[model samples]
Target: MEDSPRSQELLSLEAIYPDAELDITSYSGTITISIHSADPVGISFAAVPNTQPLYDSINYLPPLKFFFQLPETYPDTPPTVALLSLWLPEATLTALHASLLLIWDDFRDMVVFLMVDHLQEQAFVLFGLDPPIALTEVQFEFFVSYNREQLQEEFDTQSFTCEICQQYKKGKSCLRIELCRHIFCKACLLEYFSTCITAGDIEKVHCPDYECTKRVAEERKRMADPKTFITSGTSTRDMILRVVFTPPLSLDFLSFLPPEIVTRFQTLFTRDQYEFFKSNFPNRAVNCPVEACGHGIIRDDVNDDLVVCPKCRYAFCIHCTNSWHGKSMCRLAVRLDIPEDVLEQYLSYPELSKDRRDLEDYYGKFKLRRAADAWHMDVLFKEMMANELMTACPSCGVVSAKMDGCNKMTCHLCKTPFCYLCGEFLDRARPYDHFNDPVSECYRRLFEGMLGTEEELMRPIAPGFAL
Candidate 1:
């Protein structure tokens, strides 16, 4: 009926290790306590190389958890303790367990706190690390998944002043992006990115850590210590390294970006890569005035002033990015049509926005035009093959004209073997079997129409055709 001394100590542990998680239960007269380590670890071996993406993995090793069975008489009686987590070596665990008992004997009455501290200090040695680095993405995902609800509750209790809206929002409503630690309310980030994407401007994407960037120069000035030397005879000294605190938000973390924004940006990036190559090519393709529809046009002669963006359906003057003004020196300037609310929000962010007040998408428009041009050119090249006049190799995209031959063919550029008729990549070693094999869709079709006799010459080579 009355609480035991071991039970009272277990409750006191909750206060000692605030970050640590614990599970306690009583069965009959015995008490079992489970301790979950706040930290996780990963080991690299000499023979087995650590694979890529071990860094910043959301999935990695689980917490270094273990259980202890406290007898009716624990500190006074030297109770038994057990180790969990197979990641640790058996011998190391045994040694650690023995050491824990030795530690208990030092303070026979008060021992749990000392035992936990001992475990924490020796954790790195057991895991083969000196000072432990925070667990990266490798194991973060599993922990996050297992503790999502609890994490959200904890975050919701804290309040952050959103950088964009300048309004204090609870943790559940606010978001911190993947690489960059820039924090913002979900409403502001989603709307801001959506507007930019719709206008086809992706280059404007950033962590909004403008103040931190400006502070770097000031910080460098403060960090400039006098160059010093202490020589026994004549000794050289390395540069004095001062602590350079990383900005809370990293530019690298885009996981903070809305999923829809990331998806749209990827689509635009691909299109831009094609456009950039097309205009830069030797043909000197002319670009359309429209940023989103950067169609490329080929001018026939010097008097070709009338240029049309075939993709955007806009006709414009060749010399300037304006409407076709009939050679009279066009004079209207481009205007950026942005929403009032969005413009007001950007006004507070002078660090992010310099003299560019009319549009936040100036950088993005240039990128979009280049991408549009490239996408258009690639589309044209692909259309030729789509018409069936020429066969495009599935692997290399090289258009080949099959003058007169069987379906089996190989690309001259990449040396990729493929089926000419079906347009499927073929095995180089057993290329001919695709047509003659009974299981193949092109079965019994080899030399079926090559000789114009509607007869497939059995196995072996068909007289006139090459293998």
Candidate 2:
């Protein structure tokens, strides 16, 4: 067979046995191999010695780190084996090398046949020696059993209790940090993770134990296993929401929440909260008792100043719904209520259905089918609409609208096509239109410019780029 990438890698290495055969395969994201050869002078022979004592030592090793290195050729080169985080005594190495010379003639080509089965186990048996001494048959069996048991322990660390609620079962408690020798009950860590998620503080969810130096690493492991969560009892969803909203969350801190949390929160609070906020927090201020325009209160035309509304030119308190132009503490909560006609006006049943379909599709793909419920969809849609209020196309000055069965849209005034959410013009013909459109360019220039250096533009649009 033609040499594979792994074979090539082995051939390039100077330590590999000359003329040794090489085979490569992968398991659980880790690569390993089986190599066969007959030469004791070969690289494989030098790497692994097949004495009885060596087998006893290898059979006693933990399975997590067992791996075999194979040669691309045979007899001429020796293969290497690696057992991560494992070490052997120098005397053992010396004795194995000496033993190889004595058996060099009988075992030269036959060494490859020794590795004809259980490559990982072979590696564990050969690579994890600590100066092997002779062992009785019962002792040899005990060491083999130990290797098997070690692999089981590694697997148990991954298996947890209730994945949704982050709970651990009674017998399944095995929280291990690879970096630290410290171990914890899986149940404790699950509870800790839930607390972090609910508080909108996943960024801060390190190991609960203050002395654990491997907190960051442990947290990353926990996050990667999506199936690890608490499933039974009261859904912790509401508690998580309370942590996000009850305190006025900064934009920076809120970004850490999984997209699911944000989606759910949006669905739950959008309709009533959005309408109330719009009425009270309009670009124009709340109603003021100013003599010139009692009905108008300018909102945020000028930064940090309570100014007159453009339409009515009435000065009002920026804080409360009062006409106190200079006095402070008049700021009022943005009034928000779902309009009676809002159900029909903003979103039709058909649009909701499409949203539901999208959510279902997303959850199914991600294996989060339990979260793809109607109530969750409802909350997500409402939140989306709430966030998109006052979005308008800067180029055409056209207010954007979203309807089902349509993603492409054209403005009447400027003929600019853009996303409904951000009002950036999307040129329909180009492949990059979705991302590199005019609307996106404008937004980038405005916000990113302020945060970046002098060289940046809003959208980085080239002169010849499509509109």
Which candidate number has the best TM-score? 1
Give per-model CA RMSD. 27.5, 29.5
Q: Cα deviation of 86 in candidate 1 (Å)?
A: 5.2
TM-score of 2: 0.19
Where is model 1 more than 4 Å wrong at Cα? Answer: 14-61, 123-128, 131-158, 178-180, 208-263, 277-467
What's model 1's lDDT at 66?
46
Candidate 1, residue 22: how far the Cα is off, in Å: 7.8
Alpha-carbon TM-score of each model against the true structure:
0.40, 0.19
- Give the lDDT of residue 328 in candidate 2: 41
**Candidates' lDDT values, in order?**
0.55, 0.41
